[model samples]
Target: MLNYRLFGDLSSSAAPLVVLHGLLGSLDNWHTFARGQAGKRTVLAIDLRNHGDSPHVAGMSYRQMVDDVVAVLDTLAIPECYLMGHSMGGKVAMMLALQHPSRVRRLLVVDIAPKAYPPRHQALLHAMVGMPLGELSSRKQADEWLSATVKHPFERGFLLKNLGRKTEGQFYWQCNLPEIARHYLKISGFPTTDAVYPAPTLFIRGGQSDYVADTDLPMIRQAFPAAELVTVAAAGHLPHVQTPAEFTVLVEAFLG
Candidate 1:
């Protein structure tokens, strides 16, 4: 099961919003977005399984991840919620809405499509697989090792969040690295389902991102008939990071 933390008081008469992070991303990434919308509604930002403070699992797939999300909602007794997610999380949001439409009041999917994506980060995956988890002395050592194979300080830093040390001084990764590496194909592919979500849905794509292209819109519409496409100009995969003001505006309007 995935470990989760609920933010804000649910008893305060605030509508609930559940936010999920991307692959290798923690709930901390949504801190700013969650905080920005806290006044409008209660926020629940979860560390998806195998990431953040969540427990490591044996394998990962859209269906399994969606079930984890549903489990969290069930624990809270939340029959429905406004949902938002990015990258891998976006795929999860899509699955949840499709497979559990009665549980999602509205869905916001950021920078991902329902279509199968090509394996673009196999090299990065290979490098992560090579990391000597048992030999790492500290997070700094892991960073140094990852620096040799992973470029982009921000990306390296994100990956370093997974590096952790146990009380016995044994080095390990906070996330299920082995499981994720083994399920690379499943992770990149969309699950097959006849379930179509009819609820209001928004596909917020970054203008410079190849993750969600015009070609994917057809597949998105076929799965989510109510989905509307909105592009955030001058942004890449992380639209919330590059275009916060615009992103928040769209989100607010959609959720309102």
Candidate 2:
């Protein structure tokens, strides 16, 4: 089963919200957003296979990832849930709602559209895999090393979260980088399906991020016809992190 963290009251009458994070991210990434909305309803943020504290095996396909999520929901005894995901996770959420519409009460996709994207993470993943983990004594050195390819401090720090130190004084990546690298192509494309989800849906895009464009909406509406697209004008790829208050308002208004 996939690893999961819970937020808010379990006894709350509202249906639980299941959150998934982006590529190279873990459930920890959603901690701030989950905590902020904890009082309103329960939030179950999950670590997709090969991410965070979840068990890592081989497959990284969206279908396999969706199966992993379905298994988690079954294990938790949650028949239905409000679903949300960011970036790569957003694609997973879209696939889940498309495949199992009855299990999702509402869907929220952050900063991504339900379509195939060109492979853009090749350099980043290569830099990470080629990093000298053994020679790195501190995160500072690792950051400096990665700075050759990853210039932005925000992205550098985010990816570095998967780096961990063992009790024996050895550092290792917490995520399955090799597996992710191996299936990067599969992760970039979405599954072709004629399925459509008719439930309430929200698609929030970071205005500064070109991940989702106005041109993608007609195609997005084709899959999630009920989807309402909104732009977080001041934010980039991570709207929730860049502008928490505004993000919260949008989430609350949509879920309510």
TM-score against native, each model: 0.92, 0.98
lDDT, candidate 2, 60-113, per-residue tens: 999999999999889878889999999999999999999999999999999999
Candidate 1 per-residue C-alpha lDDT over 1-256 given as tens digits, one digit per residue, 9 for 90 to 100: 5666566768864559899999878888888887887568888999888888888877798888988989988888788889999999999998998888888899999998887788877787778788877777677777787787787777788777666778999877677777787887888888888889998999999998888888777878888998899999888888887789999999999998
lDDT of each: 0.84, 0.93
Q: Residue 75 of model 2: what lDDT?
A: 84
Off by over 4 Å in 2: none
Least accurate stretch of 10 residues (summed lDDT) in model 1? 6-15
Model 1 residue runs over 4 Å out of place are: 134-141, 167-170
Clashes of each: 0, 0
User: Residue 127 of candidate 2: its Cα lDDT?
Assistant: 97
